[model samples]
Target: MHEKLTIDIETTGLSNQDEILQLSVLDTMTDEVLFNSFLKPSHIKAWDEATKTHHITPEMVVNAPTINQIRDAVQKLLDKASLIVGYNHLNFDNRFLTKAGFRLPERQYDVMLKYSEYIKEPNKYPEGFNKTPYKWFKLVDCATNLGYDWESRPHDSASDARATSWCYRKLAEIN
Candidate 1:
């Protein structure tokens, strides 16, 4: 019941200045990730491995919306969010946002790092689900635990955002 907005960003490069391929977010109540978009790259040479992992071709993004365009649409989503959660934002995504020249409004919580301790503590979950056994529980783990199946593949911003929402809701329910 945490009003958390879980996000996932697929970018052309590792830095904030890099072009963003896609972005998605989910409000914590529903299983669906409500917001997602594919953005056109400002730079012609966005990386390949990053593209491969995300399964987004340059052509697909070439005609896609501009970063500023998508950002305008996403502003509403970001405004509604009480918490901003992602897989690794402090070092990566947030840095990218800084480079993007927009201040991502302060997030109430960073649930990704927080859940490490949630699962690590034996009492955080039911008996036998110990730290070693479930040492690492990503968003999919949370989805599976809560009876929401992860339908899409990973790396892409939309799927990753959906999975992240699932993971967050599960852990939030527990604690």
Candidate 2:
């Protein structure tokens, strides 16, 4: 296992070029939180249903830092990692990140779709791997099966990223 940072980002909607509302990162190897911050959205077109999902209103994002500032803050953490893990990072998070003007040097390791193909039986061997092209997996489902009581709550990136890291660590041990 590499020195990994489990990460998640809460944004205004779907585009990194858009506005990043919050960020959460954890170094699984050290079990320490590396970065956690809420960003002020520079591009808030509307605070409707999309904003409701995260439960963070535009007012809350007002005091948040600029996207560039947040990116600068995480530069060290980003540079320290070779792989970044997230639930739907490949398709979603990265898009937002790129849009936010941050370039990722490390490889994107998606954990949600990656574990989706593995059988869950105690003695079951990992099968149906090649059937899916996904590399990451859903932390909620995986964590629950792994006996973790932590549930994903809205707008809590740190907790969610750490939980996902925990799920991955536990899975790696099993393998």
Candidate 3:
């Protein structure tokens, strides 16, 4: 009976060199926000393109705590949970966390991957051919499909974590 945690991150960019600007995690069973913060990057300035997508500006994070400052607390949260869940954590969020030097738990579930696999139309392809790859869906779209209304902004990490938890529960109920 281990705890399940849901996480989401807002970053400077999509590349490996990019930094995490914000991180949020929630306890899935209790819907409690375990950790959330805006991180100040030590290097790599200018996130114009990423800013356009997440709307987190340099000014917003200028005085925020650096990832190192919060490392211990973040690690404690990570260590407490045996299962980590996120919308696109496998391909996206986890990379940013690892790049920032956090040791993650081995057990993780990607809600995006689950939903992608769940709704896949394998029969649409030829019988002899390999099934098409699972298509990724946006977090907002998953929320919409699950009929979950968001209480906060979309791109914000905390809100996304909440939405991910909501969608995960809905997906679990049916599956």
* TM-score top scorer: 3
TM-score to native of every candidate shown = 0.75, 0.80, 0.91
Per-residue error for 8 in candidate 2, Å, reads 0.3
Of candidate 3, the 10-residue stretch with the lowest lDDT total is 123-132
Residue 29 local lDDT, model 1: 59
Measured with C-alpha atoms, the lDDT of residue 90 in candidate 1 is 57
lDDT tens digits, residue span 72-167, model 1 = 556666766677777656546777665655557686455555565665643444455342422445555545655777687878777777777666
Error of 3 at 78 (Å): 0.8
Candidate 3 lands at a TM-score of 0.91
| CA deviation > 4 Å runs, candidate 2 | 15-17, 120-137, 151-154
The number of clashing residue pairs in model 1 is: 1
Which 10 successive residues of model 2 have the least lDDT summed? 120-129
Residue 49's lDDT within candidate 2 is 62
lDDT of 2 at 141: 66
Candidate 2 residue-wise lDDT, 19-79, digit = tens: 6778888886665888888888775756576677777777777777887776786866777
What overall lDDT goes with each candidate model? Answer: 0.67, 0.70, 0.87
lDDT of 3 by residue, 1-175 (tens): 3389999999999888889999998988667888899989889678999999899999999999999999998888888789999988888888888878889999999998888788884444444333337666799988998899888889999999999999899999989
